[model samples]
Target: MVADGIVSAYPVDPEDGPPVGISKDDALTLKALMSPVKGALGYSLEDARQLYLKERIGVGEDPRRHAARNRLAKLFVRAEAGGLPASTLLVDLTRQQARDVRDHMLTYEKPGGGKVAPASVKRDLTIMKAMIGHAIREFDLIKAAHNPFEALEVGISSGGEEDIAARELKETLPDAVIAAMRGNLQGELNLIWGLGSRHARLSH
Candidate 1:
């Protein structure tokens, strides 16, 4: 029976040495046992996050990277504690789940009883989205896929916008104009540049 086959897949002890050189029939039985449950669609979020952390640490770290890893770890720990199973698959994530997490991040009190900051919630959501995207790409977990994070509307304002703005400026603004916009521009100059950017977008 399939149950018996799956049960047989478990090893007995280290003293017995590793299981190897099994018969082709036994190999097939083992593969069937190890396969994901029916309807299981993607890698677990816990596994994916760990993979992301592993890759980041592989490149070594400076202060900023270390801080980022710590922040992300805190989020994952919080998520698991909030009843999100470590076994929950990334592809199973919905907008409702994303919003649930966002709401928790925004309102949950710390061990000191202080509420989480809006900025911190925003930053963590940004990191969460990027982490999911990176994990999917790196592992080919999904094929020809729609990213759950792509459509997530985490109500925070600042998350991921810096990267978007940088890309937009690179594509739309000339090098000389970009250089000129640097440093402290007076209020008038700021308004002028903002209006000019809007105009450029409309013209394009």
Candidate 2:
């Protein structure tokens, strides 16, 4: 018999023997055949987060990247406190839940006072979307088309031309100011900054 694509393997009584008509080896074979399929859909968000971090560490990810992921996890924990529980299974995550998560993130306040910036909220959501996408792909859970986090908008802007222009604006010090700042710096710091500036110019 099969339910939800899972077949019922032949039963074996460990303390006794295989049931009625089945031999031990045949039961074993059935049991092996019916082993649970592993995938991200079977994991809770927190569990998947842990697995992702563990994998990154195993592959020697940079310390800063690990710290950033931990920060994101903490943010998710806070969101859980607000309503979006980390115990939510990936398979059960609905689009409404994803929106609720974004809403909670937008409501976060810095320790000093101000609400989190829209840009920061957008960035956090982007990272979260990427993480979930990676987990889905890594576990071969489902097609990329099925990712619930895909194409989620943080509602940061009205998509106005002015907003676009403001975002694209570049702020930089004048050449004279840069030279003055370099002159004020001492030894190795100055050397490093000079080399960096030269490389930046070369790249551009």
Candidate 3:
């Protein structure tokens, strides 16, 4: 029987003497340490995401890029509303659950309406993969263990085909129209426009 916050453990051999009493806190700590999940107690996905963003900021990353990454990171927390419970500790997250997150993003709908594009879904997953990977390395988790988000194939179509199709469908602007637009632009604006036009020409 148990009393207070102490648990009794008995040895198989009667010659080993009386049962040992362990406090619940010590027992929980032992369990957490022995569990294969890894990571420190109470460390969660949201915590990892915040740390990752801070690291990026420290490296001089742009605010806009940080905002974009934050949006992607929030999807994991939002997933809890869908019953995924992504706010749990990294150690508790399984490969199947990671795949489920990918599926959720694939089927996610936009605020204005319509489903998210597959390309965008791929990008989101890629960003998440990086974030999780960063957490795993930064936390100094089990060296032999692989990250749950690693090598998940987003399976997006090749960009080459899309680019070719876009180019084929685009209507070329006439020289007169280009001349008129360029003429209305100011000094710096005209230089920027010229550079943009040159880059576009070079791309083709």
Candidate 4:
């Protein structure tokens, strides 16, 4: 039954990883990491990784995978129709998102299993905002409007939120480098470019 739903309505091959097209497993991990800022930030969980694996690879499947899969599938179809190749930067962004999600899952709870720094939600938010910025730069794409990632000013700004924001991310390389990916994509790309504009709120 579940497999049928995934195959029919989803319309995505189990191997087609994410909006940018990575391994399905990588997409799933990123989905988990972006869970906290889902609706308010429109962050994607790529939950389909586990579900796809469950249906096709024999691992445990998660139920929430459908939404993310649907979202990416739609993006992929649109991008293909529009003639834009999937950006390598976007693929890298998804990969990083997956890693952060794994880190949060392992570190979120204490030894007994509880929230560590309940007050630091903002800090996490800050990290997320920076990550998004890096995504844009790494992909070397500009946005159509203002960057939502810059507006994500939601993290704990204790002493120097300004300073942290100022800190540079090594992953966000120079513009020419990211722009260099033109025509190298194998899948979909965001309709608009840039970090400040493409951000979506997290509902979960």
- For each candidate, the alpha-carbon lDDT, in order, equals 0.64, 0.64, 0.64, 0.37
Kindly indicate the candidate among 1 and 3 with the higher lDDT.
1
Which ranges of candidate 1 are over 4 A from the true structure? 1-42, 57-61, 109-114, 144-146, 156-204
lDDT score, residue 104, model 2? 73
lDDT of 3 by residue, 137-179 (tens): 7876556344677887665432322213347568768889989
Off by over 4 Å in 4: 1-108, 144-149, 153-204
Clashes of each: 0, 0, 0, 29
Checking candidate 3 for backbone clashes, the offending pairs are none
Error of 4 at 129 (Å): 1.9
Residue 15 error, candidate 1, Å? 39
Backbone clashes, candidate 1: 0
| Tens-place lDDT digits, model 2, residues 62-177 | 78876776777776886586566776656657788777777677777768876766677677777667767767667666642245667887655322212133424666568999
In model 4, the worst 10-residue window by lDDT is 39-48
Q: How much does candidate 2 score in TM-score?
A: 0.53
